[model samples]
Target: MSRLLSKLSGGQPVASAPVSVDAHSLDPQRSAEMLAGFEAADIGWFWESDAAGRLTYLTDSAIAAIGAERDALIGSELTQFLATGDSDDLDSTSRPLKFRLASRSPISRLNVTVQTSQSKEIWWEISATPRRDANGEFAGFHGTARDITKSLAQSRDSERAAQFDSLTGLANRLRMARKLDQTLTAFKKSKRSCAIMLLDLDRFKKVNDTLGHPAGDELLKQVATRIKKLLGDHGEIGRLGGDEFQILLPDMDDRGDLGDLSKRLVQMLSQPYSVEGSRAIIGCSIGIAVAPYDGIESSELVKAADLALYAAKDAGRGTYRFYSSELSQNADWRQRIEDDLRDALTQQQFLIQYQPIVDAKTHKIASLEALLRWEHPERGRVSPADFIPVAEELGIINKIGEWVLEEVCTQLSKCPPEVRAAVNVSPIQFASEDFYDTVDAILNKTGVDPARVELEITESVFVGDLERTLKLFKKLKKRGVRLSLDDFGTGYSSLSYLRDAPFDKIKIDQSFVRGCSADDNNNSALVSAIVSMARALKMETVAEGIETKDELAMVKGHGATHLQGYLFSGPISIDELLDRFDSKELEFKPRGPEKYRAERRTEFRKIGVIHGDSRYNVFLRNLSKTGARIEGLLDVPVGTDLVLDLGDGQLAVATVRRSEGFSQGVEFETKLISDGDRGLCTRHRVSPYQIEAAGRPLGALTNSAVAAYTTGSQSVPRAFVEVDMNAYNRR
Candidate 1:
């Protein structure tokens, strides 16, 4: 190479016009040998430069093959094309040829992608050696380059095909599995958390069935685009076959964030899609699982997520659910609970607290309603919703009911003479033939006035033998004990039962009180109707479960004669009641929420707050429709936007309205709504974090090799490996 360049430069290094072959500079045999070597080896082209690194020589055939005129590239530096190479690709590992030339090092099989005259990339394998002048000073270089574009392109295409989905341009199942497994393993050692979301398009089958699979595929691609845009650069999404997708959010265990992201996903995907010039609508359900919390491994985490997904679907679709160990329990657990409930009263797990029912007219305590509480030895305080049905189904409610009556009578005998006690009777226990005698004996034994006791009955008693039920009611009323219906609208609500039965009071169910202030709600009207009917029957009316100021105002304006719920007071322990009774404060004051915007729910659950790429563990102390108070973060800035991960997949985007040490009050970007079961949910949410945990490709997928199907091109994409549905089904 040095001998050839020396001849081309004529010993003294000087910039000169590039010439193919100068017969005058070389011997005939040598020139013929060089030409033959070029033809025989099929080396693409060669160039020589002076010490100034200016192109002094160029091969005629190479210049023509590159779609370039000889004059244009002749005087240009060889590094001109290096600038236009794949320099913008962050993953590129190729050492640039320009740097090697600057170092005056020998270039050995260096690959450089350069643009041809026609604006096409032509990859070349370049090799060069520095030539020396007669004095052995550095002159220039002579090297050979061969086009390797085809081979390189083939290799990249194969790799992309193996890893990416051809349809949606998202990560395929194999890639997602590998990525998730790798991520969990790393996160586990650091004790960091990761959250994964499993979602499938709702009504996707109907789309396929009605519009055909092609349209479904198009809709899916659009869905992918929308999700990618929503997540932007925050997450990685993978298509795990059919309409199912898996999302890997690294370093995120905040269910609140995941839930918000899920809601956003459902809402976005559920929006009407214009496919094939026709409008189509669809929705989605999401299940979320976190690493180290749900599972340590990818498969276990995925299974947990799948269970949550089924739960979300079971919750009537278009929602998200977080995986919990409770979701894994079976029927055997219920049986065990039933057995435990039978022993609850005997084992001393039973306790009673009282909530006062106040007279609406004078705001004085009319009666204290006894509410049963059960604390399992192993399970702490068991919710009535969890154990009451078990007792009823096992026929243990009769003993439990009789014990509550006896216990309440004994306690009420010591209260002020005017103070009354109310005990709720289960329909099953109420129907027992000896139940009346037990109540009679308890009242006699305790020496408590029967007139001071109120027995709350449900409409369920009227289900069997109405004549006997009406007769039993009359017998009970004759005993001088007051009777009032409890949970009025929840059971077999029959006005005829009221007409014949001598009920002292009619209690309206709490369900009618909630949201009664809404413009479209009919609860106010229903409350008024019940109040009017009770008035005509000469029975007083009690509004039950009044929890909020709005509800209190609504029920009061509607003419309820009495009220009972948390607004006046929750169930107070016997000690607290004794203190109140001793103080002669039977007249309870409404000390509930004075502010209309007080915390809707005060919570202590740990959640996540994300600012930038950093997620801070915070306690969700209070949450409301438009704002939340988060603790555990120190000195957060006011006016900063943060995402709160409220567990499962619930995520709320909030801006810190007030900030102090370890606490921040934030206003939500979008207000939350009731999930129909007292839980709050974002209007649209899903977990999204700032970290590129799936290495960006999982969240940001726009690989061109698989772009044919994913890009917004009108043409059909090229071939890809097909999934055999028959074989897949067998598996």
Candidate 2:
């Protein structure tokens, strides 16, 4: 190596060509052959100058590759060959900045270009190490510079695929989390806050089950694309795992931020996803947890979000819930309560409380409203508000509601002669096919008057599939039972249900009654308006939760005929109630409670109908006639009109008010009659009347004001008038 270096540099050799080898007859040719073998490998060789970063020794291959000789590279500095406008300082600084000694820090691996002496650029993996002298002092560096241009190109491609979701082509979860961490760090530095929302697709399993896995996959892809476009760059969104996604909003600050984002996400996700020429709606419930508010740690934030998610799902899927400490507490309580409820149902720990509905006119208990009470052995009393929804969710409402109906019916049969009973039916129970049969069996077994029993359902039930609900309602009405809408105005803007179905009464929600009082902020005019609406629908209104004297007066003044609440009675025991009713004593009565009886009008009228199989007859029986009876092979439904063919073949319309198998009793349509008939009806209605002392039965009278014209002279059976089908059926 010494002889070669001296020959190559044209300088004096420091060693005398190995004196020992020369004394022992060493071969210079053999040394030359060994040096040739070392150079034949063609590894890059270079010598650096102290004044300038110049390559003094360029191998034959290196010289040919850069189109430069050793002399050209020696005089020229490497910085001179660097691309124009590119900073040497930047290139030098970035090399070390690309990595930290610690593995915990983010790795900044990069592939960069550097220029050669010939002004040609090249890419390399330049890993450097210090080349020290014998004294181990500062020395120039040596590095393994591999031409990694092809490998770098392939790595760039791999990185892109790793960073983006293949289906949506948006950022994948890994990239999203990385970006979220950076954003949160920056936001905290600026003293701002952001929100993290977790979204889950409700009933997504149904889609996969019914639509197949391919369709499900397609739906997910389409939803991803839609949500990505909707969010744009204001937030980072990614698929966390199967039908679940997460969105991070770096700019959001407060609860409003979460609420607004939740609403937007819900709205965006509400639309149908079209895939493979088919459409499906994927509803998402968002659980929001705000950074620096809900939690500071990412894992804590995610847990809060998950808790809220369960809350939204519990409330009913396809909604949103904001994270709160209460949500976690409630979730825990709900879990325990759910377990307890299952046990309670099995153990029969629930009971019903009957609330008497006094007839405003009679001041007597006309009906009892059966309300459920949870007899939780340890917890004392839980309001229906607390557990009824839970029961509904757990699918125990049907059993509970059935128990209420049957129990109320049985109790009603044991009550005094005129008291009826009303039980509240859940929408879930209403949806059951066996509901009618169960109700019928209860009525029949208890021997309770179907006319005296009523079922109350909330308006939300009717709001859901109107046609279906109407059909069910009609079936109930046909069985000689009464139907009422409970909490009418509080939910689902008042629909014209009275006109569509035979709803006997409408119970005004406590909200309106509470609002009518002095302490309440609601305008009295609004109460009057609701009353007016109820009146227009021809439905009686019963105001619930009337407490104060002012509230009672307001309710009565607004034309609410019947009232019930804590003011009237706080659901007394049946025995206690019977004692009060038997003694005619009022313990929990209101100040103006007596006024309700005196104010009710008693100008009643008995409506009568006579009909055969094909033709029909209608009559308005006198109000004084108490011995009314109906009979025949008439197959008219309860609400169908009965047209009596008078001698002139005129049509006097009457409604089939009530029915008993083949026999039906009808009520005259006073407003629906002709002006002449209306005058006649009105005159007769006001006429002072007494039972005529005739040779007929004491209670029998053919009260058909006008004779009916029949094709055949078939005498109307006046003998059956005093039988009283309602009374006979009671026996």
Candidate 3:
């Protein structure tokens, strides 16, 4: 009976002596409940056994990190849940397993990749410690496992972000810089060569302005993707901001590689991209600076590449250029010229010459085109093509153009009244702020009539800022001055601008005029077409560069209304022009038909007093009490304002009935005209002294004394006149 009781008790498990004294003495359920609370607190609590090298107890966090259920991990070997070869070999002896066990120093860290029971992979930072019995002997281990997948992913993303552009998800300039630096280093070490290419999209500003910035951004993105696909791991590409991109070729040996690559890039970029349903094609100008050949350093390479970029752009865009020493030298010279041009505009080094524009019908020079002359102190005469573009690019053309306008207007005020002048304006100057206001100020200063002043713009002026151009043209047209298109066949010379643009005259390009006398079908057809189009549009056509009589005849044959070239006179100085004008009367004679009668009355009053030819015969019929009936063979219009000098200090004004041609009677305009012993002086035509003595009409000249002095007839002195000419005239 005792043996059975002992066996049953042994089978049932012996109850320990109930040594519970304090109320806090924990039961197994209470201990398990405390561990559950630790799991709920996000603390990974785990225990390993020495016998089987397996996890015995694991909290919820440990189980979740290990990605296994508690029951699955409880008695299983920890190596099954861990990465392979992570377990220590164990013996039958219940000693601690020999392994690279992390020390149990509170919270610790271990970098490792952990696999879950469901074959899920993750990164982990584990902290483990050796568990000891009450005697401090190593019994097993306990540890915490933290999932580091999110942190690792974040780190990787940060790394990638540093190397890429945030806007386009492409490599950025910094990445490009670093990559080029690495490439150069490699080239130096390996004795191999490479190329750095800089790309600029042609006319990208037009895209930005016409399609809006959002569309521009979409276009840039598409361009980036296309470039990436073109490069395709063969090279590196980077955005250097605003339609500029950089490409690095790390191991390009043959120059053909660069050529092939640039060709491909251009081809790809030239393909049309759809932005907001608008198909737009973008083309790139690529400049390549070779390594160890063009430059040794990265910065130098990039600079040379940029110079090559500008070279491509300068060569009319949509092209590629290789860096060379001569190109660099040329770039330096261009920069210096630009600087000098800026200073020249401020330093008053520019002057103007007037080229005569001969009337086709009369062969008389009626107007002079103002030509820009750069009297450089050092360089002498710089060509307009050389410096004008530089001035335009630097935005100094506005100031220079205004200076020219003011100077030309002042000159015109001093010139003969029959001669009008035209000044050329750059596109930049035309687009200037307060352009019309500037013109008004100049005209007011110089006292020039708006009708006598003309402005000429090259064909390039009409292509930019369409709305602003329209507004400006409308305002200028209201001012009654003529605007002309100079060099009509050059540079974006579209017929649309000719029809839409408010232009009064078209100056056929010198290229056309040089070939005007040639009998070639192409040349003759071009000139004829320009003239015919101008005639149809009611725009006067002026043929330029007419150097010979044959050229002049050719131009006239083509229906050119005006001609300006060496055939009439080359651009001459003011002194030279004064020598050219003969003894002539320049009068502001109104050409309207209504003014013909008054002109007849004046002719009748000067009939016997001013005898020249019987073709200009005039007769006074009846002397009335208040007015005189003038009978003349002159056909004067009815509304003509005539200044008639009667004898004995009496003068009268008149209108004519027979004003159209030489005919019969005409009536007086009024009883008030300049009189006093001042009969019309003829026979010797009109001498300056006689006109000044009688204080008679000086014609176009408002001041008689000033006119006489200017005509080299009167020895009068004026402070404003240039001194040398007056001193010589007095002698």
User: What are the per-residue Cα lDDT tens digits for candidate 1 across 1-731?
Assistant: 44454454343322222226665677656665755565455555666777777776666666666778767777778777433256433236656666777788776766676656577777766667787877989988876666778987887788778889999999999999999988877876665778889988866775676568899899889989998998887768989899999888887755456766777787777666778865566678888877765676788889888877865764546678777554556234666786677777878999999988899877788888998999788878877655776676587888888889989988888788888888988766887789879889988898889998899997656642466777888888899889988877652465666788999988898878776766776989999998988889998888988777787888899899899988888888888988888887777677675323333787767666665545555677788888988776666778988878765345678999998776789999878765423457654323122222422222211212112211233354522222232343368
What lDDT is obtained when candidate 3 is compared to the true structure?
A: 0.62
Ranking by lDDT: 1, 3, 2
RMSD of each candidate? 20.7, 29.6, 31.0
Residue 152's C-alpha lDDT in candidate 1? Answer: 76
Please provide the root mean square deviation of candidate 2 (C-alpha atoms, Å).
Answer: 29.6
Where in model 3 is the C-alpha error above 4 Å? Answer: 1-171, 178-237, 247-293, 308-347, 354-369, 382-395, 413-421, 458-465, 486-497, 506-536, 540-731
Q: Which parts of model 2 are misplaced by more than 4 Å?
A: 1-186, 196-288, 309-322, 356-366, 463-465, 494-499, 517-525, 586-588, 591-731
Model 2 collision count:
0
Candidate-wise lDDT, in order: 0.73, 0.58, 0.62
Candidate 3: tens digits of C-alpha lDDT, residues 225-309 = 9988878897888888788988888766344456667777776786556787654555678887766655668888898889878
Model 2 global lDDT (CA atoms, 0 to 1): 0.58
* Model 3 TM-score (2 dp): 0.47
Q: TM-score for all predictions?
A: 0.49, 0.49, 0.47
Superposed by TM-score, candidate 2 places the C-alpha of residue 199 at a distance from the truth, in angstroms, of 7.6
Best by lDDT: 1
Question: Candidate 2 on 1-731: residue-level lDDT in tens?
Answer: 34333332232221212112221232556544543454455442222322224433333554565565566665565445322223421244453322321122222222345455445546543333333345855333322233455665676668868887776666677887787777766765565666788889865665575467888888888778778787888787888768888888875644544565676777777665665665455567778766655565566677888987877766545567766555677877887778898788668788777766654544355567888888889888776755776887798888888777777777677676666677888766886668888888888887888988889986545432456678878888899999888876542443455578778888887767764655436646667887787788787778787766677778788887677876667786767866776786643456444222101123223333434423433333322111112354245567765543322112345666777755556555542211110111121110001121212222111233223222224554432232344444468
